[model samples]
Target: MKTPNHFKLTALAAIFSCFVLTACNGANSSTASSTADVILTIPVEAVLTRHGEISSSYRTTATLEARGEAEVISKATGIVQHILVEEGDAVSAGQLLAQLDNERQQYSLNKEKAELNRLASELTRTKEMHERKLISSDVFEKLQWQFDAMQASVNLAELALKETEVRAPISGVISRRYAKLGQLVNQYATQSLFHIVSNQQLEAVVHLPEQQLAQARIGQNALLEFAGMLPVNAELVRISPVVDAASGTVRAVLRVANEQQLLKPGMFAQVQLQFDVKADALLLPKRALMTTDNSPTVFVVNAENKVSRKPVSLGYQSDNTVEILSGLALGDKVVIAGQSALKDDALVNVVSVKQFE
Candidate 1:
């Protein structure tokens, strides 16, 4: 239908405006609906359970030690002439450790020997005269006593001279050297020649609490550890009967054979005291448990195919596994990996157990 020009233009403009408004409203509503329908997809992994034995060992670090150790000191007063052995050298009982300048001691011994010879000759003549009735028995007895005294003096002098040559008292290895060549030494002076440590056997001394004393006994099997050697078998040799009043702990000694002589004495040692054993317990790898706020927890698969964190009570842990004291049931799948991105009710996909490994 043909109408006036101005009226037709106005009608066309109104129609275009209405169409633009309707299009704008429809676009806004579509955008809002799309935003509400948005869903996030996250990747996840599954959990599993396995059966294994968990060691109930109380883990502690210890040190190596020698069975018997001593400090070699000089007994006589003299100047050090020579030092034969050095540190880290093997020594045996009665082995020459060091030598002292024994010039004076040798002269004393020689003088005593000469004096004894003269006395012996005098006593012989006196004895002959007395037997022939030319001398009284009292005179012959006095000569005999003087000769015996001189003989004893000579023997003592020889012993003193021999002591100048220092000797080892026990079979061990020389661990230190203090006496040097030309150093003055005396009975009261500090003349530490060497430090000998018996390395054929090693002993571990540990202070255990009073409560653990009853559990410790003689001949009990123990494991010994050192710095560079593997764990070696040992036996409980002794335990102090009385507890230390100040420390309230008893000392325990474990004897270990040192076939390789790897252990040294005076080394601080730690000991693991196995007080009891658990016949059966649910154990899991220590890696499986995660801590949040000091409360130990583990992830388990829920029915909705999601991971849920469950708090667990723990007992003794050893090697790598920890005992599940409570809050876990048998056959429950535990998440060993993919824990970093996990959240409550998060979706999960079962990957191979190798992922945890």
Candidate 2:
């Protein structure tokens, strides 16, 4: 139906006005929805900051070793008569450990003593003759030399006889027993009789990179974690003065106390040498921090129940916790979980608050 031109223009204007009005209303509704969503709070788990001890540690692995060890060699040459101690036996210093064939030594010592007694009696007679001027000075001097030689032979025989009884050179656990009863042993250094080690104190032997040489120090506190065992306390006892050219690592040692005798030599352990510590520091769990950026960041929940993105400076960091040098304080709450969806000044609901022990 063809209508008048003015009427058609009026109808088109009316349609355009209606479309613009509907578009404006829809935009206003979308703005209101966005505002409502902005007010919505996110649920998260948080940890409260506290003043405690925090430390920076250098972590490395090492093998357990005995602080005092020795391989004892036989000192007597004869057939082994008896082995008093066996492997896994504890021994005290100077305690008899083994007995070689001492019968022959005893016989020789007795013969030498008899000869010494005979010489003593002859020397007395010779001295008496010399004093009476019946014997020449040369004869008296010969008798004196003979008597001295006999005395020295007897003394040597007694010493050799005593050596047949092998005594423990040090107090330690018998880790190895190479000597056997009725087996021929020699005084030569090549024949090892026993291996003794003082297991009461252990050592963690580790190699440190040259860069850490400056940080390694004697008497420094350390923590050791061994497999199948609880964590043990240790102290830095030694640091090598030279570097190994082949590995380019310096040798470092930590002493571990073993009053319970749990630590054994050759066991591998994880060592964390505490190089620096901050006492009475504001600390938080490392999970509370977002470290995947140029600067370390955290989401701190304020008293208003809003989350604020914070960039913080750190002091010392251990494996689990880190010291907050700035941008956080004691009693401040930090988001430890459900922080991926958080934003600055975002409303939040803390479902749980954990304390750092």
Candidate 3:
């Protein structure tokens, strides 16, 4: 049938537009299929579980103190004339800590010296007289005795003079100063002149319950943890031979060598003692275990990359690992990371494997 050229042209243009639209729709469908065919995977990190040694640690609070300490005291009855050191001053054995006024001691020493000189001269004269028969033997012997007594007196006075200087009895840091300048100090006084403590090595003094005595022993390894400080190495040095009847506790002493002099006395620290290490124990990182339904559970991946929520029985827990008593076998792969985003039977792609070091 004859039709208008403008109408024919319009119909042709409409058909071409429809063909282009159909082609575009087909391409979109193919692209969507390609995307769907690609297997969606969740990247994750995993570890191959194995059996390792694990131990349970018991913690007790303690204080780090000097291994050796002494109370310095005055040796002579006199007033404190001078103090050579203050608190926190490091001192050595026999180092002068304070000095008493030496006026009286010096006078006594001088008097003894003059008497000894006179007696010595008298003895010399008496010996010459006795040898020449100018004096009796008895007189000469008396002069010799007098000279000996005077000499001994001089020795005593010299010793007393030395006692005027109060010296440290031990090498340590001065922790407390009890003597003040011009303070009357007695030789027989019970008051301590200075409190000195050794800082070269420290002790972790702990009083543990009697029950813990079974685990604590000499030479056992221990760790000392201080605030804002790294754990220090320590060992059990002493255990009290007897337990306190009132507290039912036994005293334990752990020694920590402060070779670098990093720790000071009276610092609070926690003592961690590990015991009963279970070798060949089925262990896993603590992060792998999660509380599921109020029970310890873990996500274990299978060969097909499918996860299974495993309810595990735990025995002991160490620093960052736990002992798996049941519900897992050796050579199983565990999801240590990305475990929170998984469900039972969920597919996963292990992006990386973590090695135990």
Q: 137-254, model 3: which lDDT tens digit per residue?
A: 8888878888888889999999999998999998999999999999998888766899999999988888878887887768878888889999998988888999999999988888
Score candidate 3 by TM-score against the native. Answer: 0.70
Give one digit per residue, the lDDT tens place, for model 2 in 187-270: 875688999999999888888889888877789999888878789999988898999999999988888999888888998888
Candidate 2's TM-score reads 0.84
How do the residues 1-357 of candidate 1 rate in per-residue lDDT, one tens digit apiece?
766997989999999999999999999999987765442223444445444454444334556577778888888999999889999999999999899999999999999999999998888888889989999988888888888899999999999999899999899999888888888887896557888989999877777778766666677667665556576777778888889999998877778787786566665445554545565777766777889899999888766667789999998777666788897886677777677667777666656443221
Better of 2 and 3 by TM-score: 2
lDDT of each: 0.77, 0.89, 0.87
Query: For model 3, how many clashes?
Result: 0
Pairs clashing in candidate 1? 65-264, 66-264, 66-265
Error of 2 at 338 (Å): 2.8
lDDT of 3 at 60: 83
What ranking of all candidate models by lDDT puts the best one first? 2, 3, 1
> What is the number of backbone collisions in each predicted candidate, taken in the order shown?
3, 0, 0
